[model samples]
Target: MQLLLVFQGRKLRITVILGAHNVRDREQSQQRIHVRQWVIHPKYSCEGFKNDIVLLKVGINTSPPAHLPKPLNLFLVPSGAECEVAGWGRTSLTGNGSNVMREVELKVQKEKICQQLFKNYQPQSMICVGDDYRKKGVYKGDSGGPLICNQKAHGIASHVPYGYVYPEVFTRISYFKPWIREQLRKFSLQDLPGSPFSD
Candidate 1:
């Protein structure tokens, strides 16, 4: 799978490390991946739940590793579809986060049900997934990981309740497709070499 190289935090520097396994020393394991550009959805808000997607442009032209290819989610994901959520997040509600990445299967919940569970739920931009009664889902430190359905990157882990009691929320990629396309267009106009901007 093609990896999205993101530069965040106060320093804003490029660094990479494999997600599948644990690294003993983060600084020593660093591998730099260039980022052409990135854009956070204009309507996104830290204080609110809507529009929590971000699109990144990586400077890589090589074929993806092995059988992994870039995922495309151009259509709306239907509710009840089984999706995989993977991340280096907490294994349990009160447990310490994992060093190695973990993945779990979850079913997408209906928007109506999600709205009932969360008063501020944004059906147009956000999706809710996981077991409503069972405590199985993405937890702390899982934000920003991919939610894969049918081998397509359909969602981004956005939020979960403080006590990890509620179903995990995700920013629906299909809902923000227009904005994503617009951002790619804007970035491509700059004509940067090896820019990862394509339909």
Candidate 2:
């Protein structure tokens, strides 16, 4: 199956690794895929942080064969739902980034909470996720990671307020499902025979 990936616009990197557990280990099943193209949201902005998402196309070449994870369909994530976020980011307020991948369980906060916390919070496009006690949350270098809930990617880590605050903002995946579908359809056609963009 062909894999089309999505992530936060600002997190576009040179490459992505699949089946990676430890950041420092060169696992036998791990595959490094170079980023080939990035389709940023038309309305995305650095200041307001609205529509802070991007579609990614990657070039895959691996020895011993490698396959990407199954793409999860977007779905509505309920408030107070349990979810997980993983990344190789800092574990503490004063610690450096970790060499091993770490994951933290968080709860999806209500839109009312986000609206109260952030001036630019958009209920239709953003999700509030973190622990109520401000204990569990994504740290630096965790931006653009997936907020997985119910076996699907319900959101993309958008931004965290200064001082590592609780209830971080995330780009709601369900709200952009139409735009994502359209982009995938458009890109699929671009790879068709006789298309100038086709390889």
Candidate 3:
């Protein structure tokens, strides 16, 4: 169990390294356990910012394998896609500190709310993940967490609009699997024979 330490700000984060990130096909990469930690979601590319994006593919400094241009290949799941959202961010608006790192299930939103929220942006490239105002929304510290759908990662916790209130946002992984692989291979790979996403 080799641990890779990622330096951010004044703290160091750890990552478990295993195999060459190999897959029988590109689709396999989509099902692999999402390991994107502190990268930026390319959606903010307009600012000439790259590292600010958090991704499910690899570290914040890199991009997915060239072939996998889709930032989130698994992000846009079929209707009725059941997913889980996890984080160590915040449990409430006024929590003195982050809540215990946790995971919660959320149904992908399909209502017109999705349409209305992005009336001024590129809505097709992005997907909505939460509607439960009481629970499952990302708060102050839960950035770059994984959103798993069907036991596979679907998106990365990216951002929330209007102060983490009603609808929160996530970076779709379904659209970016191929490119993610390209960017991640340079880091390190893991060979989990019976791992959850090894199929």
List of clashing residue pairs for candidate 1 = none
What is the TM-score (0 to 1) of candidate 2?
A: 0.82
Candidate lDDT scores, in order, read 0.71, 0.78, 0.51
Q: Measured by TM-score, how close is model 1 to the native structure?
A: 0.75
Q: After superposition, how far is residue 42 of candidate 2 from its true place, in Å?
A: 0.8
Q: Which stretches of candidate 1 lie over 4 Å from their true place?
A: 1-9, 25-31, 62-75, 132-134, 192-199
lDDT at 125, model 2: 84
- How many clashes in each structure? 0, 0, 42
- Strongest candidate by TM-score: 2
| Candidates arranged by TM-score, highest first | 2, 1, 3
Model 3: CA > 4 A from native = 1-43, 46-76, 118-121, 132-136, 185-199
lDDT (10s digit) by residue, model 2, range 1-199: 2344446555435676888888788989788887667688999988758999998766744544221223343336778789888998888778988988888899988788888878889978888888658487887888898888877777888888768657799898778877887987887887789998765
Which residue pairs show backbone clashes in model 2?
none
* lDDT of residue 102 for candidate 2: 89
**Residue runs of model 2 more than 4 Å from their true location after superposition:** 1-13, 60-75, 132-134
lDDT of 1: 0.71
Model 1 CA lDDT for position 18 = 40
